[model samples]
Target chain A: MLAVQTIADGLVLGGLYALAAVGFSLIFGVLGVVNLSHGAIVMMGAYLTWFVWHTTGLDPLLAIPPVMLVLFAFGYVYQRGLIQLAVDRSSLLASMLVTFGVALMLRNLLVLVFSPDFKSITPGYAFNYLRLGEVTIDLVRISALAASLALLGALAWVLNRTRIGRVIRATAQQELAARLCGVNARHVYGMTFGVSAAFAGASGAILGIVLPFAPPDEANWTLNAFVVVVLGGVGSPSGALLGGLVLGLISTATSQLIGPAFPNAMMFLILVLMLMVRPAGLLGNAFAASR
Target chain B: MLAEALARHRWWIALTLLGIAAAAVVPFVLMPFHVRVGQMILLSTGLGLAWTLLGGFAGYWSFGHTAFIGLGAFAAGLFEVNALGTEFMRTDPLLGFALGLLAGMAACAVAAALVAWPILRLRGIYFAVAMLGVAQVLSELTNSIEAFQGSLGLVLPRIPAFGLRTEAVFYYLLLIAAVIILAIAFLVKNARIGQGLAAMREDEDTARMLGVPTERYKITMFVLSAALTGALGVIYAHSLGYITTGSVYRTDFSLNMIVYNLLGGIGTLVGPLIGAAIMVLLTQVVLGSFLNLHMFLTGAMLVALVVAAPKGIMGGLAGTWQSWRRRRTAAP
Candidate 1:
């Protein structure tokens, strides 16, 4: 029964990790750099959702769309304004450093407004748990899981079916070829970045429910996103989903088997092991193939 | 003709001598707090310079370089507590100090070489993130292990002999360390190994095709840097007196290294020194009320530097000079 409950909980966290990793991987897929600020975007989304809940007393679930939209705009403007210049440099390290810079800015601004103290959003139903015989799950975790899976579904649909998705994928595959095909390179890149940010924001909102966060949490979030993307494959969304689930289980199991401090260590160990054993990751081979 | 060249460069010679003299006497000139700040600058500059050799020169960019630092600190602390008996550790801290630093250096070099050999093959972001993970794992192990004092760390039994005059004692230590780091960096920048690293940075494939022993060169440099950085960590831990996993195993130091090195001029010899000075000032002076704001400034500076001048402060000036010279030649 305990085992069943632990696995179920791992799946819930995995769903959340998948949502977080997808946006991060998408940005990496479309753009060569691993948008270091993706976690900050998620952090921003969490704060925004918390704000909506704090001021209007709205259900946090309903707040995801507006938060995602705002984050999308923010991401678009950020890419067009600053990163456009960096992208031209054509160095992965430079772009990653650039986003690290933006992340620092965002983290500081968040701290300026919110202070360095940890904050969490708990709606009335946050504490409620759904019990099913030997298995039990927190309602908040379930909602986060459901919300993330739904968004993942929507993202998968867009990437596989839609025109914009196809353009974004083509650009990822070959930027010059895509540009020659009249793809409006900057616009497509900006749109793809915005979508990626929106996904991050949604994940952030869910993160607020699952855990308490301060300004520095963004760095950890970014690290986890990287671990997920690398584990899944650099440019694969479905790969991200699987990676997230695997990380979730691994982290949860580590916490259960060892101690809480061990999970963070385990995540990195797995990452190191993966890089050494299979740099392409479980689903990573398609990364260079597409991007 | 040689005499004329010497006369023309007289100002540079005078300034260089003047700078050395000033550094020698700085302990007496500044107040104790600022002396501490100077010590900070020396430490940061030293760390940044060490990082420059690996990330800046070799183009590997290990975001987990802090792992070496944490391990060094832990190794030093463990040596002081476990190896040195309480009696000897208290009275002859100088002996323990020397041994602690040596232990830190040996442990760091071994760790870096062992890890770098396998991990360096991954390339780019994977290598960077993997390095970060390595650091995180080491830190966590320190946090969980009782042998590491289990997050409480260790208090170096303070022998007043070691810090009879805190300002003079550490200032000289830091100054000497910084000088050594800068000197080694200058030496490395001019050597055959340095040229190999430059070639590797520009294009590994081309360098390899040209018969550069890129693997051996990278591991050697990485080990050298790890030893240097670990030595710096020993000094840092000693100065602090009390060292803990949370305090010593700071990943943020890795970020600072990257930022400072990049800000100063990623590959330039003097860039890290300049960058570290500016960063230490901001961190110490303007830290309390505006801690997060400082972070914002650091980040904004990074973004701006990368976009407008990817070469950093020193690199930017060099770029301008080259461009201006080209323009002048073409003006006719």
Candidate 2:
């Protein structure tokens, strides 16, 4: 019964992790640039949702769409304005450094605005719980998990079926060829960043209900996304889902078996070991065939 | 051959000696705060040079060089506190310190060696992130494990030497460390191994095909750099007179080391020194009053630096001079 409960909890957490990581994975896959400030974007989403809920007394889950829209615009402008400039001016690694700098700036801004304290959203159903057989789960967690899966499903569908998605993938495989084929590679890149940021923001909203968060949590989220990408493979929603599930399971198992303090150590240990054993990840890069 | 090599770089050697002489008198002439700043500049320069051995010269940019820093500090701290005991440390504190420093360096070397084989196989970003994971794991271990006492923190013994003030003593020690690091960096840059490393940086597979012993050179440099960084960390821990995991395993220290190299000129001996000096002065003196804005300003500076001068100060100057020379020749 305890094991079953642990597994259920892991699945819920996994859903959140997948949602959090998908944007970073997509950016890495399509743009070939590790967006180091990804966590800040996620945090921005959470904070925005919180702001909306705080001001209007609206439900947190219902605020996700507006928060995501704001983030999409922010991500689009950020990519086109700053990231594009960095990529043009310097090497990819140097561009990564630019993102690092931006991350620090954004984090500092967050601290100034939000004050480094942990904030969480508590709705009307905050204390409700569901009991199925011998297992019990919170209503907020179940909804958070459901929301995460729905978002991931939506992302997967758009990428698989949409015209813009195909253009982004083509640009990722061959930027020049895509340009030759009448695709504005830069615009597509911006759109991909926008989509990524929207998803990140949605996850952040869900995360706000599940876990308390502060400005500094941005670093952990970024690192978590990197680990997810490394574990699940790069560039696809399915890969992120797989990686997130495994990571969530591992984290839950570590805390259950050893102690809560050991999960981060275990996560990083697994990260290094995974990189050494299979640099391509379990599923491998989605666009590896194109390369 | 040694004498010939020395004669060839006579002017460079003289300038270095002159700089050292000037630096030596800094504690005597400056305020205590300035002397502390000098100590920081020296420490940063040493760390930057150590990082350059691998990151700049070998093209293996590590995002977690602070692993060695934290590891060295804790290793020495544990040994000094537990193994040597307070009685021995109190009796002959200098010898205890020397032994602790050696132990710290040894720990770092061993740790680097353990990870080098699996890690060195990774290229580019993989290598960087793997190093980051290493640092993160080590710090987490230090924090979680009660034996390490990282959460509790450890206090270091005060080094009583030459009847000098604490800041002055550390300043001299850091100066010595920086000079030693600079000397090692200069020697390595001119050596045969340096040539091999240059080729490896250009193209690792091709360098290996050309019989450059790339693997051996990389491991050697990694161990050497880790050991040197460990030594600096020990001295820094002593200067602090206390240390926690947070103090030694700072991500900012790792980032600053890279920034210094990038700001001055990557893969150059003098670049880190110049970069460290500029950054220390900028942060400590110019922007010191704006405590909360430090991160924002540093980030802004980094973004501006990358966009405007990607090749750094030395590279930009060299480029300008080269263009001028080309124009002079082309006019005729």
Candidate 3:
């Protein structure tokens, strides 16, 4: 029963990780560029939702769509204007540096405006819990899990079924080939970044409801998302879902079994071991195998 | 032509050496507080060199270098803290310093190997993100462990009355470390390994095909970098007489190192040192004034540097010099 409770709790946490990782994976898959600013966007979305909820008495869930739209536009413009210039550069280091500069700018901006204090969004029912058999779960956690699952399902469907999804996958597989086949790789890349941003925005809204956050919290999320994405597979959507679950279970189990401190070290150790043994991640095809 | 160029630059080299000599002697002549600041500048220069090895040369940007520094400081602190209160465990201060350096390097090597294995497979932005994750994970681990003193942090006991508390001693120590690091950098830049590193940075696949053992070079450079960084951390801890996760393991330090390299001129031998000096001086000016305004000014400076000259101040000056030479040769 204790084990069951831990697993259940782990699964709930995994949902959030999955949401973050999927957005990260989507951008990497479609654009072949890691969005370093994804975490900041996630933080911004959370703050936006929190502010709306605090000032206007709007439901945080209802604020998600508007936030997503705004962030999507922001991502689109960012890629079209700034990132497009670096698209032709063989070394992606320039883009990474640019994004890092942007992140620093955003962080300092946040510090100037919001200060360094931690803030959390607390609705009336934030801590409300529901008990099922011997397992007790927070209502907010359950809702967040459900919402994340729904988003993942919808994303998977869009990737598999939609016309834009086909173009995105094609672009990911071979950019020149896709271009020769009359696909506008640039447009797809921009749209794909937009979608990834929207996913991140939604995740942020969920995170705002569930966790205490400050400006630096974005860096934490970005780091964890990178781990999750790598653990799952760089460009695999389903891999992200499984990776999050595995990471969540490992972290929770390690905390329960050993001490809380051991989990992070253990997680990194596992990641390292996995990389040495299998560089393509657990589910990912080997580099040679993919070729 | 190369020898002639070197001959022409002899005066500049002489001037630089003289500057170093002057800097070395200033702590004895200046106030104690200024000496302390000089010591900090020298320490930061060591860190900047460590960063230069990997980021500046190999093009493998690591934002988690603070982990090594923090580990070094903690190891040294652990020796001083006497957590177990054992007399035999107590060693000479110099031995403690050496142990701290080794332990810090070993920790960084182990952590780097573990983290870099998976992340190294990634390119560009993904790689940077992975490094950030590594830092966060290590910091979180540090925070969660009680033996590490968790958030309260481990405090080092004061050194026995050795009469080495004078700022001049610290200045000399720091200057020696700085020289050693610079010598290493000079040797590395002129060696075959440097050529291989340059090739790797220019293009990895081509470098590998051309018989450069990219992975081995990266790991070796990273380890060396971490070891030097750790040694500097030990020195810093001893000078400050306190160690904390917040101070030792800071992203700000990592970012500042990158900025220093960039502002000085990445890939150049003397860039990081010059960059460190400039940044430290700028920081002093900023911090001397109002807090908010200082940050705003620094931010503005960073923006201007990035926009106006991404190659760095040194690179821009070199370009100008080269253009003037070209025009002079072309005329008449």
Candidate 4:
């Protein structure tokens, strides 16, 4: 029963991780550029949700679509104007730096506008929980988990079946080849980045439920997302799901067993060990082959 | 010809010497607060160069170098606490300095080895994130540990005579270290290993195929970079007369170092130094007045520079010069 409870908790957290990691992995897969600004986008989404909830008394979950739309447009414009310039450059390091600069600007902008206050959207049912035999589960966590899995499934289906998805995957594999094959590679890349931003926006809405939202604290989320993506395998969505679960479980389990301080260390240690043993990651080779 | 060349370079060297000489005499000219700021610039320059070894030369961008800097600072602080044998003891400052530097380097090397194992395998942004994780974990561990003073941080034994005690001496010491590091950067830029690093930067697989031993070079450069940064940490701790997790493990320092390197020009020997000087001066002039607006302006500047002049200030100047020369040559 205790083990079941832990698993339940892990799965809930894992769901959030999955949402974060998948968006990160998708950006990497489609563009071959790590969107370092993804976490900041998530933070922005969270802030937007919080603002709507506070002002209009709307449920945070209900605020997702509007937030997603805003971020999607931002991502589209950013990529077209900025990221495309670096696509041909040998080092994506510059892109990462640029995004980091953007992130710093965004974070400071938020701080200036909102101040460094922690905010959360606590719906009327925020504290509600369901009893399952001997274990209890939070309704919010369960919903977040379900939504995450459903989103992941939808994304997987889209990538496998949809024309746009095909174009994105093709571009990921070979940009020039995709271009030669009559695919508007630039449009696909921009759309893919927008979709990635939407995923992050959705994740942000969910994260506001799980944790309090702090504007400058997006750096933590960004770092954690990076670890999850790397651990899962860079460009694999399913791998991201598994990686997030594994990380969430490891972090949760380690925190429970040893103490809170050791979980981060253990997670980093695991990452180091994994990289030493498998540079391509457990699920990365297949995607690497595709690329 | 050698004499002529030496004579020509002499003016440049003299100007540098004169600058340092003026800096050394700054304690008498400026307020103590300004002197402290000067000390910070000298210390940060060492750190900026330390970051350049990997980020600029090897093209491995580490976003968590604060772990090394912090570790170095704490190790030095610990040594100071024990060696002085008094809460306020300032005796045998030289011994404290030696121990602090050695411990800083040793700790950084070990931390680098630990961090490098997982992070080095990942490329680009993944590597940067992994480093941040390492730094956060270390900071948490440091915060939880009791002997390291936990979250409250460790206080160094204050030396007698505030002005004459250590800050000025540490300033000169840091300045000397910076010059040595600059010389080392020049040597590394021209050496076989430097060539290997450049090749790897150009194309990793091709460099490996050409027998560059990419991993060895990466780790070596990472360790060397950490060592220099650690030394800076020791100097920083001694100059400040206190050590805390907040001061030591600052992410802003890491960010500033990266900004400095990029703002000056990447993959250039003098770039980090130039970047550090410009940034430090900017901060001193601008941030000192408008603290809140500083970050906003810096971020905007970084974005603008990346878009407008990706090669940075130095690179932009060189590009303009080359274009002018090409046009002049074509006039014939």
Candidate 5:
């Protein structure tokens, strides 16, 4: 019974992790830029959702669209204004530094605005729970998990079916070739960043109901996203889902078998080990593997 | 070859020694607060140089060099506190410190060597992130493990200062550490290994194809860098007189090392020194009042620095000097 409960909980957590990481993986797969500020953006989304819920008494789930839209715009401008400049001036590595700098600045901003206190969304259903056999689960987590899966599914459809998706894919595989085919590479990159931020923000909104979050939690989110990408591979929603599920399982198992405090240590240990053993991840780079 | 390189940079060498001599008088003239600032500069310089051994020379930008710093501090702390016993530490504080420093360096060296084989296989950003994972794992373990006492924190013995004030003593200690680190970097930069590292950094596969022993050079540099960083970390822990996992295993310290190297000049001996001096002055002296805005300003400066002068202050100056020299010769 405990094992079943743990698995259920792990799957729910995994759903959230996948949703959080999919955007980061997409950006890495498409632009090859590790946006360290990704966590800050996620935090921004959470705070925005929390603010909306706090002030207007709107459902946290309903706030996702607005939060994501805001983040998407912010992401696009950030990519075009600063990250693009850094990459053009120096190398990809220096661009990493730029993102890191922005991450710090954004974190500072979040702290100033949000006061570094943990914030969570508690809807009327927050106290509600359902029991199936010996396993008990909260309504908030179930809703969060449902929302995460729905968003991830939506992202997968957009990437596979949309005209813009094909263009983005083309640019990822061959930027010059895409440009020759009249694809605006820069615009594609910016759009990809925007889409990534939108998804990340949506995840933040979902996560707000599941976990309490503060400014410093940004680092953990970023690392968690990185670990997810590494585990599942990069650039696709399915890959992120697979990675997140695996990570969620490992995390829960570690906490259950070892201790609660050891999960982070175990996660990082596995991150290094996974990198050493299989750098391409389980699914491999979805877009670039063919190349 | 070493002699030839020394002869080529004799004037620069003289300037460094002269600068050191001038710095020796800083403790006497400056306030304790300023001396502490000096201590920070020296520590940063030493750490930056240590990082440069692998990062600048071998082009493996570790995002978690603080792994060594934290490990070294804890290793020394544990050794001094638990292993050596309080009575032994009390009787011979200096000797205990020396032994603790040795233990710290040894621990870092061993840890680096163990991880080097697998971790070094990763390249660029992957390598950077993997090192971060390493640091995160270590810090988590230190905090969680009851024996490490990282969460509880450890108090270090106060060393005999030879009649000097505590701040001055630490300042001088860090100064010597920085100088030693600089000397090692300088020697490595001029050595045959340095040339091989340069080649490896440019193109590892090509360097390996040319029989440069890239793997050996990388592992050697990694171990050396970790050990040196560990040595500096031990002194830093002593200066603090107490340490938690948070204090020594700071992410900002890791970032600052890279920032210092970036702000000065990557792959240059004098770059980290200049960068450290400028940053320490800016943060500690200039913007000291605005503690809350520190991260914001540092981030802004980093962004501006990357966009405006990607090659860094030294690299920009070198470019100007090159053009000026070219123009002078062209006139003739």
Candidate 6:
């Protein structure tokens, strides 16, 4: 029963990781810059949803659209006003510093305004669980997982089947080629950031459904996202899903069997080991050249 | 040309060193509280200078430098904390400080050497990520390990009647460290090794093709960087009179180190010093007024620096002055 529960929990956690990592990997792929601030963006999503839900007494899930929309605009303007300048200067150090600085500012601002207290949203269904013969699962977990899978599907459809998707792919693969093809690479970059942040914000709201969050908790999510990106491969959408599940299972199993604190170290260890053993990550072929 | 340049600046170099030595008195002359604050500023300069080798010079970008720092702090803690499983240095006082510092240096250097081989094979972002992971592992390991007292942390025993009040002594020691680090950076920057590292930073394949021995030089600079920073970590740990795993390996230190280097100007000798002073002043004088807005302001400052002045204050100002001189001459 415990084993079944852990596996079930792992699956739900994996869903969260996949949802977050997709956007993170997307930003990395298109911009060629790791959005170090992605975690803060994720945190922002959760807080925004909670704020809307708390004040208006609205259904928490209803807040997703507005949360996503706000984050999307923020990410877009953030890329154009700040990140584009770094890109223009053609400095990796500048981009990294700027993203990190923004992330730091966001983290601190959240703490300053929110008072470092952990905030949780209690929808009516937060504790209601669906029992499966001898095992039970929270409805929130199942809904969050379904939402993530849906987001992943929508992301896939956009990337694989749409015009903007093609532009994004072209810009990511070869910015100059995309430019020569009459695509505005800069605009595509901004669009990519917007799309990715929307996905990230939605996933973060889903995550907020399950886990109460504090300011520093965002860094934890960011680190896990990095693990997912590395485990899955930098640019592979499917790879992120697979990697997320792999990590979720591993961490769930480890934490269940060992101490709770051990999984963080273990996850990071696996990440480093993966980088050494396979620089291209698990699904090596898709974006092997990224490193 | 090189000889002429040195001849022109020989007095300037001597005067600077002399000035640092002379300024050591300001700490003792001022109130004890002021000395303590000065000590922190000096410590930042020392750590920033040491960081320049890998971060600025070699361009390795070890983001998890907190690993070395934590390890170095623990190395000192082991001697001073006097737990059930410790030996040596316990019987002796002065010998402990000397041996403890050496141990700190060696531990970080060896740790860096251990990971450098596998990590250095990768490039840029990958290496940075790996370092971050390494730090996480080390911090966790420290917290979980019984020898580290399971994160409750250890308090160092104060030396009985040590020369110069402990605070003043540590302050002077920090000043010396800052001076030593600056001297080492200057020497390395002017040497053949520095040029090799510079070449490797610019283009490793080209440097390798040019017979620059890229791997050896990178590891050397990295080890040296770790050793110096590790040394500071030791002093920092014991100076606190109590050290904890979380405090020593805090991510803020690593972030601040990176920001200080970038804020001044990467790859320049005086940049870290200039950056550290400005950062300390901002934190101490300006942001000090805010209840908890320091981090926010620091982050804002970092973003502004990167956006408006990516080359940093020193590099950006120099470029502007040079361009202005060119424009004036052309107009004439």
lDDT per residue, candidate 1, B1-332, as tens digits? 44554477578557756766798788778788888888888889899999988888988887877888888988887887788867878778788888888999999999888887677776777677677778777887888877788477688655344434766687788788877887787668667888899999999989989999999999998999999999998888888888888777775687789988887888886788788988788768867466546777777777877787777788888989999999999999
- Which candidate comes out best when scored by lDDT? 5
Off by over 4 Å in 4: A86-90, A286-291, B1-15, B31-37, B82-84, B159-170, B190-192, B203-215, B241-243
**lDDT tens digits, residues B106-196, model 6?**
8899988988887777677767767777877788888887777638887765543355887788887788888888888877877789889
Tens digit of per-residue lDDT, candidate 4, span B109-226: 9888766755786766667867777778777788887778748878775433445635566667788888777767756766788889999888788999999999999998999898
lDDT of 4 by residue, A146-181 (tens): 878887888888888998888888998898999999
Q: How accurately is candidate 4 docked according to DockQ?
A: 0.48
Clashing pairs in 4: A272-B118
TM-score for each prediction?
A: 0.92, 0.96, 0.86, 0.90, 0.97, 0.92
Provide the clashing-pair count of each candidate structure: 1, 0, 0, 1, 0, 0
Two-chain DockQ for each candidate model: 0.53, 0.56, 0.28, 0.48, 0.61, 0.58
Fnat scores for every prediction: 0.73, 0.59, 0.26, 0.53, 0.71, 0.59
Stretch of 10 with least lDDT, candidate 4 chain B: B157-166
Best by TM-score: 5
Candidate 4: give its CA RMSD in angstroms. Answer: 3.2
Pairwise lDDT winner, candidates 5 and 6: 5
Task: Summarize candidate 5's per-residue lDDT along B1-332 as a digit string, tens digits.
Answer: 99999999999999999999998999999999999999999999999999999999999999889999999999999999989999998899999999999999999999999999988988888788778778878888898888999999999988889999999999999999899999999999999999999999998989999999999999999999999999999999999999999899987788888999999999999999999999999998999999998888888888989999998999999999999999999995
Q: Clash pairs of candidate 1? A: A233-A284
Query: CAPRI verdict on model 1?
Result: medium
TM-score of 1: 0.92
RMSD of each: 3.5, 1.9, 4.0, 3.2, 1.8, 2.8
Once model 6 is optimally superposed onto the true structure by TM-score, how far is the C-alpha of residue B166 displaced, in angstroms?
4.2
lDDT of 5 by residue, A26-47 (tens): 9999999987888888888999
Model 3 chain B poorest 10 in a row by lDDT = B82-91
- Look at candidate 5 and tell me the lDDT of residue B286: 97
Question: What RMSD value applies to candidate 3?
Answer: 4.0
Ranking by lDDT: 5, 2, 1, 6, 4, 3
